[model samples]
Target: MTDVTPTPTPTPLLEVAMPALLRHARHTYGAAMRAALAARGYDDIPANGLYVIGALALGEAPLGQIIRELRVSKQAAGQLVDALVLRGYLEREVDPQDRRRLTVTLTERGQAAADTQREAREGIDGALLACMGEEKVLHAREVLAALIGIGREGE
Candidate 1:
């Protein structure tokens, strides 16, 4: 009897590339930020908590808005906010115009954390630009922006 050779299956492309790319970028940037913050005696904050702090980088925002922006469950957002508040990175106050609403603002420490994240991101971006060139990186940014815009369209 003649032996038959088995056919090899081809590898499939990722179903969605953005999520994988974003996850990798987040992990890399988070590590750099964590290292920088740790060097400055700010090691208590977790990497995930940094996202919440970054969301408030612009200014105070309602808790509900932050939850929406974060795209996280209410419970998850609340836990993150609670942790940040306990770590002195954030503060919550009642909205003057709407006492029923709670607003979140970054503390000085939170601002420092956000600044560290920015620096880390800049470093990562520079490295990416060097590796992939400005044209490709800029194109990628545009694509990412478009994708985000699509996500926000429903809001």
Candidate 2:
């Protein structure tokens, strides 16, 4: 009798296209963040709102950066900001340095919401780190960053 060696089959994840993997992977973080936000009473953020609020929370990001990151038109960005302002999560004030221009700042409610968002994101990061281990996580980050760079090179 001849001994048989079974052929290896690719894992489901290994067979997924990068784009599909990215989309689904994004949903995992989105679900975690949304669940956390809802539990913490921050369910009011609109579609595309999370990126803006979280960016503001992290620090000063330029309008150009926001537009690029959101992949949104300037008009769309303005409308989003307006909606956030109306929701009481953000406030717009006349720029002290330039009276003709306005500055958007986070309201107290926004700050709380941002904190919740950060915690939720950190939770996902921690889970990934634990599951993938340190070296593997770092390599994953490098690969993702390279993918992002590919997009930028086209722009």
Candidate 3:
């Protein structure tokens, strides 16, 4: 019999590009949260809308803050917030401190969605902890946060 050589599987493109890998990870997390929300009769919520919802999960915040924190264009942020408002997941009110500014707050339904998203995130965190161990996962989070901080320093 002739000698045979084994071929190795190719690495995924995401693995080669750090940005792509981070994006893929975000997409995967978003998809999981969307699926959980849909199962709870929240199918109307769009994938991109979660960014705004999550930003407001802690409490109400100005539209500009959400746009900046999410790193999305003003138009895109406005569109997503408008859609969420229409879907009854969010409410926009004039800021008392700054009448010119609008604050986006979560409605009862929006709070539910945020809760579901948190649960999904916890599940993902658990999975990552299981696979990578607590130390590694925590370290990874630190590394990502540091990287993000570095990017912000440029602004």
Candidate 4:
């Protein structure tokens, strides 16, 4: 038998590039989350779809509420919801209280996807907690929350 060793992959240049570090981090996290969710049978949903499903998984909500909570434009949120509905992950229905308004809710499939995504997030959060410790994780969360609040205030 010929002796052959597997070749090692090269480290990407962007991994060490400062300006693209944040983008790399975001991509890495998204990839990890996607992989984790896929392992749990959520391969059909993209990250954006997962976010939208997550919001609706809580309970049925008006279209406007989803747009506001996600901080996305009406067109963007509608597109996302439409895609999810097409994929059979969500159902759009007329609100019982207000027939004129449309409400969106997760279907059984969407609920499963949301649960898998939530579990993946918890896994990542737990790893971050282990790496940074509870105190630092809490501090980081506070900082992020503050930043989000400030951003909304400015807008």
lDDT of 1 by residue, 1-155 (tens): 97789866644434447688688766888888888888887788854687777767966675577678777887877788888899999988898999998778889998998898788778888899899999999898899899889988977
TM-score of each: 0.75, 0.90, 0.81, 0.74
In candidate 2, list every pair of residues with a backbone clash.
none
45, model 2: CA deviation in Å?
A: 0.5
List, residue by residue over 15-55, the lDDT tens digit for candidate 4: 57644765675576677768977887777774477667776
lDDT of 3 by residue, 14-106 (tens): 357888788888888888899999999988986577877887887667557777887777787778888999999998888899999877789
The CA lDDT of each predicted structure is 0.80, 0.89, 0.85, 0.76
Tell me the lDDT of model 1 at 146.
95
Error of 1 at 26 (Å): 2.5
Could you tell me the TM-score of candidate 2? 0.90
Provide the lDDT at 144 for model 4. Answer: 66
Q: Distance (Å) between predicted and true CA of 117, model 1?
A: 1.1
* Candidate with the greatest lDDT versus the true structure: 2
Which segments of model 2 are wrong by more than 4 Å? 1-9
Which stretches in model 4 have alpha-carbon errors above 4 Å?
1-25, 60-62, 69-72
lDDT of 3: 0.85
Residue-wise lDDT of candidate 2 within 37-58, one digit each (tens)? Answer: 9998888888888888889887
